[model samples]
Each structure stands twice: as structure tokens, then as C-alpha cells.
Target: MDCASRKFYHKHEFDCRDFLEKYCADKPDMEFAEDALQFPTMSFHYVFSSGFVKGDVLIDISMGPLIHHLYSACDIFKDIIILKLNEGCNMETSRWANTRTGAFEWRHTSAYVSKLEGKSAQIQDKEMKLKEAISHIICCDFENENITHPVVLPLADCITSIWILDAISKDEDEYMKNLEKVSKLLRPGGHLILIAALNTTFFMTGGERIYILKHDANFVINALSKVGFVIEYYAVQMRRNDSTLIDYEGVMFFTFRKTK
Candidate 1:
């Protein structure tokens, strides 16, 4: 099955506002290290806020229209290019970036992240920065592994993808292969921020079951190592027992830097 044809983003309500409300509104009982959403945001904030791990360009591969992770990137990088699998995700993202009314509002998410970073009053300010930093929303094919082929894009200084491989891959082999292929987009010594669901095979959205490639921490660690990345930070948040939402044991966030 063509991964793009699955149209998960089209059916799912994956707006940033919905994501924050559903997964991040309430503080987790566990420490920051054990909270999936919080951990990723905090880790990103800590790293990028330090003025380290920054570059002129950051490319987001298979981003699926989610800008939650871009909060920190916008502050650290001068330009952001978002590459997605299909047009639907691109359209939705463009709507939000261009501030079209009725588009999913993400000011709340910006405000929350500002609060996390001790800049509670800079919510609107950060939103404006995010809007300015995002320079492009283009389509790319992960399976092809030639994201900017025929017209190569400037090598990215950092790449961030969240649950993109699992959501699109048919199996572990495909997932690993795609990971290596996508990692090529980064320049040597560039950073990679990855967030994935642990041991999850499926998620529900719009009354439909969306299948994903099941994977665990060991698999991901080995996969990245094999593809010339060194892990810098790793964390996971155990999933709460919820029959109503997705069934996954946990969410894992990993920060890696390309070595070769």
C-alpha cells in the first residue's frame, strides 16, 4: 500500500491545538523525563535555547502538519522547510502558517510552550516568529529517498520527524531503510530529533484504524547507530491505559547527531 494514499492526516484531527489539549493540557504525574510530550518540548527547549545545535536551515521531513516541535526550532534557526508526504497535510499547514481564519488555532500551544520556557508573556511573539521562520511547505516522498532530487535542497543543519516512519512504513525493515534514507538529508554533525510510539501497531482516528510499523527502543537505537547517528539523549513516557485512544505502551523521544 502506498503510504501517502492512506491519508491519515486527512481523516485524523491532528491539529496542533487538538494535540496539545488531548495530550499536554494536564501535567503528567511522572517526572519531566517520563512525560512524552513534555519531555520532547523541554528537551528541545533546553538544547536550542542554549544557542547550541543551531544552523541557518532546518528541514522537517514527513512532518504531517504538526508544528508543536517547531517552537524551539523557530527560535534557533533562521529558516524552516517542512516536507510532507502529501498535499493535504501541506494545505492544512499552509492554512495555519498564513493565518487563515478557521484554520486550527495554535496560539494556545505557543503560549503553553512560552510558559514552559519562562516566557509566559511572549506567546503571541513566539507565534509570530514561528510564522516567519517557516519558509516553505513542500511535498516529499520518503520511500523514494530522493527528497529534493533533480533539484537538491541545501543540506539541512538539523532534521526533526515525529512518528513519521512508524506511521508510513509497512514493517521494521522498511522503517529502518527509510530512516537511513531520510537521515541523508542532514549535513554531517547535524542534529536529528525523533519522536516515536513504542510498540504501537495502530491508532484510531475519525472512526478508522490507521496501521503503523511496530517498534521498540532497542530497535530504534540500533537502527540510528547503524545509520551513522550517535544518540545524545533518550527518554520515554509510559502510556496510560486507555481503551478509548491509541494503544501504545509508551512514546520515545531521541536526540541524535550525525557522525559521518
Candidate 2:
């Protein structure tokens, strides 16, 4: 995104609402819109209690509405490290993450993750802005030369994975592989907070679409344990509004502590 008046490069992002209302609204869909509107509350809870601060490195797989909260969240944190994994992402949010006081910006793009598709819905909201600051760096996807297996780097005080896990693999092994790769980013005792759509086979919102393997809370917990994360807190919701015919995501938010 250009600084003066702003012109973002990645213009084609999947709209969040379009996905929520389409395939996901069927039975065990997610209320991504409502949850997105609650960005203030969720960010407050995660940043405050989850130990996110100016020094934390947040390596997120996707940059859609899953990050809508961060549009405003950039206010409280600096030294932010982002692994965007796609180029046509919301540069506006990157600007917000950059301009905020003390917040340094960084990005990593990967086509493999983009192959995961539905990356656009990750940052669907247009309202996100930089209240104060510019990112430190933004890198397009580069090749990984070493480590056939996922690396475990102690690069951040906290690590977060939201909505990306389920979509990564329905096959247990592949999903676990992604989790292991993500765990390398955090130090032991560091926190990992995640929000994922549950019991979902497929969903659509804002002209963007996504697919899932249809798992539940227990499946996630077991996977975390295998990857050396201890479940600290977890919650799942599957309720439909009487006025609305749709049933929102049996969403699950889990907080885990890295235990050596």
C-alpha cells in the first residue's frame, strides 16, 4: 500500500460476509461476521491475557478477516512480525500494523499457503486502518532450503493459529504437520490462541469459499497434545439465532501453553 492516501496492491480478496452467508449458513456454519464485529473484545482478551505486546512476533498463515481484529489491534502492539503467505493481501491492514506506535511491520508470502485458497476472506473488512505507523519488511514467498520437517524456532513470545489448521488438512498427519511447523515459532510456556470453524464440511461468504474435514473440539485437543502444546483453555459454540435460519460455526477458541 502507498503511504499518501493509500493504494493497496492486492485488490482481489475474498469477502468475509459472502462466505458466511453462502455454504456455511447451512447447519453447523460460523458467524464470522458477528465475530468479526467483535474484533475489539476478542483482541482485548487475547492481547491482554494471552501476553501479546510490542515485542511479540505473530506469524499468521492467512490474512483475511481472521485478522480483522488486528486492524484495530495494531494500536496496542508493535514489533509485529507477520507471515502473510500471499501477495494480494490487504495492504491496508499491513499499514495499520505498521503505523501504530512501536509496531514494526514484516510479511512473508507463500504460494503453497495460497494454494490453501480462500486466503482473501482472512482480511475481508475494509475499515481496518493505521491509527499511528509502517511495516518493517514485506517478503514475497521464498523457498525453504533446509529442514524437510517443520522447523521449531524460538522466534516469538507467543504464537497464534486461527482458522488455518482445519483447512490445512483433513488428513490427521498433514494437519499435525502444520501445527508442528507453527509451534517452532514460540518458546516453551508461550501461549497459542486459536479460533476455528467447527463441524464444517464447506462454507462460503463474501464471494470467497472454504472447505473443512468436519472435526470437533476433541480432535483439536488431541492434535495439540501430540504437537507438545498443553491445552490451557478451550470453548466451543454451536447455536442458531431464532430469527435467522442459519446456524453459525460451532466455533472453537483454544488457548494452549507450550510445555517442554
Candidate 3:
């Protein structure tokens, strides 16, 4: 029986957001480390994404399991820059995001990893191995309604994000505007890397259907090109399986450079 096809398995009792929310509620403690698997969702993301290394900078918006896994896997850069939306701040209300250590435990899998992977300085150990340090974004409000030029990101040499742009904006102009704002903190020749999902739809979860937009890789690529990003490296389907996924959307990964 094919799970991807209907009639093969149990009806989905939950929607994506419901699962996302519930994952936070049920397992508050384990959400951080398990998220590392997100990188391999596509074929190329794992191969190309050079996780935190010395002298590098990054910003993660809509902090998810991926970032936590990353913090564990590689020492990204000298100055680790983080960016999160309004959702990132509220730890108590929001499930796994603990501002205290900048780790997200919202997903049960992630929460589970947070605790079991004890005696961590795993982050520091990886950083020591990679030779780097972490730096906080100065503004602390990447979600501000107030937009300005040169969006300030301290110690930023480059930026990296995973599936955040389409997740945040349904309105095209607003989405483009936000990316432009994010660009201000980056210096010329800086890179912007992403692990993204392709065309998708409203998924039903805990009890509600969440409206998610499908993004055409070309559309995103065109948008980035318009915004001073020179496409450097792009890999589709970064070597991970969704064999268990029931007719879900596909994933795309990219690496771009700031030419302006």
C-alpha cells in the first residue's frame, strides 16, 4: 500500500500547523537537536551548506529545528547572526524556542534531542572544532513593521536561512520588500543560502487547514536576482527522502551572493 496515495493508510488526523503546534506542547524539552534532519530534505542542501565556520555570519528567521541541528553539526562562523520574526521571542507561549540559549524545542523530535544529547557544549565543541563564535543580531526585531534602509545586522559576513521567505509573506511585494530589508545588513560579496519547499497547498493537521503558498523555484530565483543577489550555486532535491510523506510538496535549496 502506498502511503502517498489516499486509501493506503490512516486518515490524517492533524494538519501541518496543528502538528507544528502540538509538537511544541507535548514535548517541550526535546525540540532542538532533532531538527538537524531538515537539511537533508533535499538532495543538495546537505552537500553544499557549509554550516557555521569561523568568521562567518548567519540569520535564521522563524527559528526551526534546522537551525538547532546546525548549531550541533558545524561551527558556522566567527560571528553567528540570528534573525527571527515576532514568533521567535515568545518562548512560553510558542513551544520550543528558548531565548536563553537560542535553541528551539517546538517540535517534539527537536525537544527530545535537546535533552538526550546531554552534556552539550556540542555547540561550543563544534564551534571550537570549526573555530567560531556566536553574535546576536543587534535590533532584535527583524519583524518590525517599520522598514528602513541598511537593516542593521551586527558582525554579519553573510546570511543563511531555511524556508523562511515564503513562510512569512503571501503578498509578493511585501515578500520582496522584506528581503530587501534583510539585505541591508549584508556587505557586498556576501552570500545568502536557503533550503526551501516548492509548490504546496493548505495542509490539514491538529484541526485546521493552514494556508501555505506554493513557490515556483524560478519565481524565487528571479526575485533574488532582482534584489542584487547573483546566483552562485543552486541544488534541487537535497538528498533526503520524503518516502513517508503523503503527497507533500518538494524542496529546493540555493546559495546566492550579494553583488551590490
Candidate 4:
């Protein structure tokens, strides 16, 4: 599909459950599991464990209701605030956070994270801690001056945005604008952890072709510099599965600090 013909992610209703099944499920045979699940899980574990980003409040701006990456952050950050672009994501995330019936099962992912910490037996405990740490899940508009308008939030110590910019931005300028907006949520010298799919044009989710901004590592570095963020650490996980669902070369993880 052409760029103009492709579906804009923020304009349509997202099938959160379908997205979880396609990418976040624990099935070993799932084609994009390595790129979508294991990479972020491992990266977040390492970032948090290394004490590279210290903070009490963590603001998460992600594409959908994916929470597997936050398991590690919840152990370190006392207050976890999630900002979603749509109410569907909010409800879906709330279902899991509240442990309501029909919520998508995440025990398998949690078990993997626990094993990484060498405390596999504390899976349930980890889940409970995450649930409690998540103080709020608010719907937001990145274009607005106050992304979380009508409910002001204190500047966050750390912010983690995973794959949202790639899926939502229509071009490089919009991506930079979105990045700048997200950076405003962090205090000076605070950290921003970004995980992006490299050189991706689009992704297939819920039988729909969603547009993803195509950009390389250099472009991202330049954008961050323009937004006053300095990269502290960088890592990339090369694509392990030749999945036709997404046209991504690899996934890049960056730990950046706001310089001003």
C-alpha cells in the first residue's frame, strides 16, 4: 500500500487484543516475538538493573496496551504513569492493571522477566508490584501544549516511549515534533528511553496496514539532538525472524538524557 493509502494509526480504532496476540503473546512460533517482545523486555531489564536511569516517576508513552516492558521499570520507579492516544488502549491496559476478567494473560511475559532477574518464583509478586506502581493511565494528545491537559502532571524523572512515534508519525518532521513533545514531560537532566523499529515503512496489525515512519539511526540521533536530548547508551537487536508482518530491519534501544 502507498503511504497515502495506508491507515493512520491514531485516526482509527486499534484492536488492542489483536495487537497483543500478534506481537506480545508468549507463543514460541510467533514470527515477530523476538523483535516485539524479547528485545524490549531484555533492554528494559538491563537499563533498569544498571541504575542508568534513576527516577521516582516514570511516564510511558507507547503504541498500544503493551505492558511487558514496564515490568522491569515498576520495580525501580515508584510512580508509573501511562499515557495512551486512545481510550481503547486505556481500557485494555486498565483491564490488565486491575486484573479484571477477560484481560489478556501476561504471566508468561512476567515469568520471562522474573527469570532474567534470577527470581523466577516471584512472578506473581512482580505482577502485583507493577499493578500497584501504575498510578494512572491517562489518554493524551501529543500535539497539545499539555499532553495531559485538564489533569496536570509533575515533570517526570524518566519517560519511555516504545514504537509509538514510528507508528503514528507521518514524516520526519512530525516524528521530531512528537519527540520534542514527549521530551517536555521530562525534567532537565532526566532520562528518556526510546525503543524504535529501524527502517520500517509499515506494519500489519489486525489485518490492517499501518503506516510507520521510515528512518535510520542517524536521523533519530539528529532528531534527539535537535530536541535537546543527548544519547547516553545505544543498542540494536537485529531482526531474527523474517516476518512478513513488518518490514523492519532491526530494533534500536536508546537511553538519552535531556541536556537543557
Candidate 5:
């Protein structure tokens, strides 16, 4: 596929519902579930349970309106703010948050987290806590100086960005610049839990091929270092499924602390 022919997430109209159905749905037959839903949810649960991330406020800048990654976070953070690149995503998330009709079901994901926490019976309670923890869902512009513009948000104690940088960035320079912009959202000494898809060029979603910056772990480590973030933990999970939805070799998870 021609790279130029691919759709850019920032320029395209993302179908949030379609995205959920394709990657995040609870169907046992979904090919992308292991990578899209399980890997992130499990990694997050472990990160929070192991005492690696502790914060009163967490800001999530992830692709789509996915909340599976935030299940464990709700237990650790008092406030959770989600920043999306478009209003559609924000509205989709609000639907789930408010328990509106036709919202994508996340109980399976939450149940997985609960099982990891050894409280499988408290799945409902876990979901309730996460809903209550989400304080705001605001639209943001990564290219703007003030990502959230007009609404100055409190510096977060930790920020979680999952598969967002690669999806929106057109090249390495833009990726680095966006990384710098995201770093400013954290206060000094705050942690950033970042997850990236390794060497993925494009992902098929909503019946369209979306572009992803094809990069490796070394580039990410160097970028984090240059942005004054000290990497404390890094792990890579090799791709488990042989799905053509996305050609990611593996998923890389990093825990970094801001030094300045």
C-alpha cells in the first residue's frame, strides 16, 4: 500500500464505534483482542499493582476512546482526565462514562483486571470506581502550545499515552515534538507510562488504513532521554497473533520519570 494513500488520524474522521468493534470488543473470535485489549490491560494492571505508578491525578492520551487500560489506574489515582484529539471520541467516551445506551461494553476488560487483582467478584464495583474516577474528557490539539487550550489543566502526577504518538505523527520529527509537548503535561518528578506499537506502518480500522510511524525501541528510548525523562523500566511483548490488522512486531511498554 502506498504510504501517501493511507489516512492520517488527525485529518480523518475516526469511527470510534467501529474501532471498538474491530479491536476492543469482547468477542472471543476477535483476532486483534490479544494485542489491542489484553496486552494493554494486563500491562497496566501489573504496573499499578507492583507499585511502579502512584499518583493522585492521571492524564490519559490514548488512541480512540478505549478505557480498558484505565481499569487498574482508577484504583491508584484520585482523578483521571482523558484528552482526545477529536470531539467524536470525547462524546463516545462520555457515553460510556454516563452509561448511555449503545455504549461499547467494557465489563470483559474490567473483569480481566479484577481477576488479575484477585478480586474477580468485585468486577461491578471496579467498573463503578473507574467511572467515578474519570473527572473530565476534553478535546486536545497536539500541535497547539496549550494542548487543551483555554482550559488549563492541573499538572498531572502521571500520564499514560498508548499507541497515540505513532498514530498521529507523520514522521520522526513530529513524533519527537509531540513527545515534548506531552512531557509538559507532567510536573517535575512525575511518571509517564507509555506504550508503543513497534515497527507498525499502518493499521486497518473503520474500513480504512490508518498510518502509524514505523519506529523501534531504540528511537523511543533516545527520544525519552532527550526529553529529560529517565527511563526506569522497559519491556517488550512480542506480537502474539498473526493478524494482518496491524503489522506491529511487538508492543513496548516504558515507565519514565521526568527529571526537569
Candidate 6:
């Protein structure tokens, strides 16, 4: 399966300020309780506070340059391996991790995560910690099922996949196959922290439209269970349909333990 997409991730402005100003606030489209703010805030709350297993390695198989989901895993895992589907995304994330000049700045995102955890005054400190925690960034593909290629890397204690399957799979069958590939990289009983946009058909990046799998919470739950994941925690934030910026009906986040 060819995972390449014509639309590149670097073309989009995933700026922290822009994201915060647009979706994180309580607007006419989103209420205070069910706004997009819940993703980052609640993700942090769940991973750190829910007795989730912490170990030597954590793999983040993100579809784009976004690293907001990595905030919670930084402190918990000793080594954070960011595996990207393309070179552009790999370089983008690595640039940020290495503090390179002109890197897509995420200090604001780090600051917000800190503020959510009652450490509002320690924004810079959080950024530094996240940078240190990230060990490497490399190219990987879910379809290949050999994410590390010639070198077989050690199985990770946990895997965090956010909005990746929707971007890669054309249908539920392919989605389930990709899920199995991801499951192979985790140790038995390891945790899988997944987040996805519900009922999303497409997303715009760099003026180009990218198709996505339109699935709801039940689809994700059933898929995970069939793939031998025991559901531990699940939640969803119903997306308000008033915004044209992104067309998604809702957001779903869940944590599951690999049963076999």
C-alpha cells in the first residue's frame, strides 16, 4: 500500500497559538465542557493520572508534524521514538526536538500543557524536558509492518497513534490490517493510546484536500476489541458543526491494553 499523499504536512500552519485561538476556546460552535480543549487537557490527565504503564521506550506514530499528544509521554517514558510516515514529517518533528533554528515552535503548546497540570509558571521548563525526553525521529510505515526496517527495534511499552489510520487507510478493512501491524510492535499487555477524529471525511492541508476514513466511536471500539485490545478508558468530544476550518463531527480518545 502506498502511503504517500500529495499534500505535505509542512505546508500547514499547525501553530500552537492558531490552534488555541481557533478550537481551544469556548465559542459559539463549542461549549466550555465539550470543546476541542478536552483533547490535550484530558489526554494529559488520563495518561499521567490513570496508572498507565511507564517504561524504557514509547513510540509515537503520528501522521503529521503535530506533537501535542507527546506532552504526556515525555516524562513517563525514558526514550521517546517518533516514527513518521514520511520524511517531511520526520524532519519537521526532529527539527523541533533538536531545537534547530526555524523549527515549528511548540513552546506555546508545551506551556499550555504545563498550565493544565498546575505548572503554569514552568512553561520553558516543560519544553526543555520534552526535548530531552525525545530520543530519536525516524521514517516508518504502518502498511509495511516492519516499521524499523533492517534493524529490528525493541518492542515498546506503549504506542500513541493519533489521526494516523484515518489518513492512511481507504476503508475499515485496511484500517484493521494497519491496526494489527501496529499491535505487533507492542509487547503483550502493553498500552495503546489512540486518538482520532470521528465522522471526518477529509481535511485541508496547504490548500489541498486529503481524504480520511469516516468512522465513529463504535467503529474504533469494535476494531480495537477485535484486534485483542482490552478497552480501559474511552471518551469522545462531539465536534460542533459550525466551523469551516475543519469538518469533523467529533473527537475520540481511548487507552487500551494488548490482551495477547
For all candidates in order, the CA lDDT equals 0.74, 0.47, 0.47, 0.89, 0.89, 0.73
Q: State the lDDT of candidate 2 residue by residue for 1-260, as single tens digits.
A: 12232211122344533432332232344433334324323443455444433344544444342343344334444444455434323343354444454222212111112222334343322123222222332432322321122433336656555566665454577677767767766777777767766676544435333445567888888998987888877766554332232233566777777886
Clashes of 3: 27
Q: Taking the tens digit of each residue's C-alpha lDDT, what string does model 1 give over 118-192?
A: 899989889889889999888777646686555578889999888888887777787778887788789999998
> Residue by residue across 1-260, what tens digits does model 6's lDDT show?
23355332322333333333344433455442343444645675667656666777888886576676677677788788888777666777777788888676566567667877888898888888878988888887554668578657789899988788777777799889989988988999899988888798776544456667889888998999998998888878777556566688888888889999
Residue 119, model 6, lDDT: 89
RMSD of 3: 8.9
Worst 10 residues of 4 by lDDT: 1-10
RMSD of 6: 4.5
Candidate 6 has a TM-score of: 0.85
Q: Order the candidates by lDDT, highest first — what do you get?
A: 5, 4, 1, 6, 2, 3
On TM-score, the stronger of 1 and 5 is 5
Badly placed stretches (over 4 Å) of model 1 are: 1-37, 241-243
lDDT agreement of model 4 with the native: 0.89
RMSD of each: 4.2, 12.3, 8.9, 1.2, 1.3, 4.5
Quote the lDDT for 40 in model 4.
Answer: 90
Q: Identify the leading candidate in terms of lDDT.
A: 5
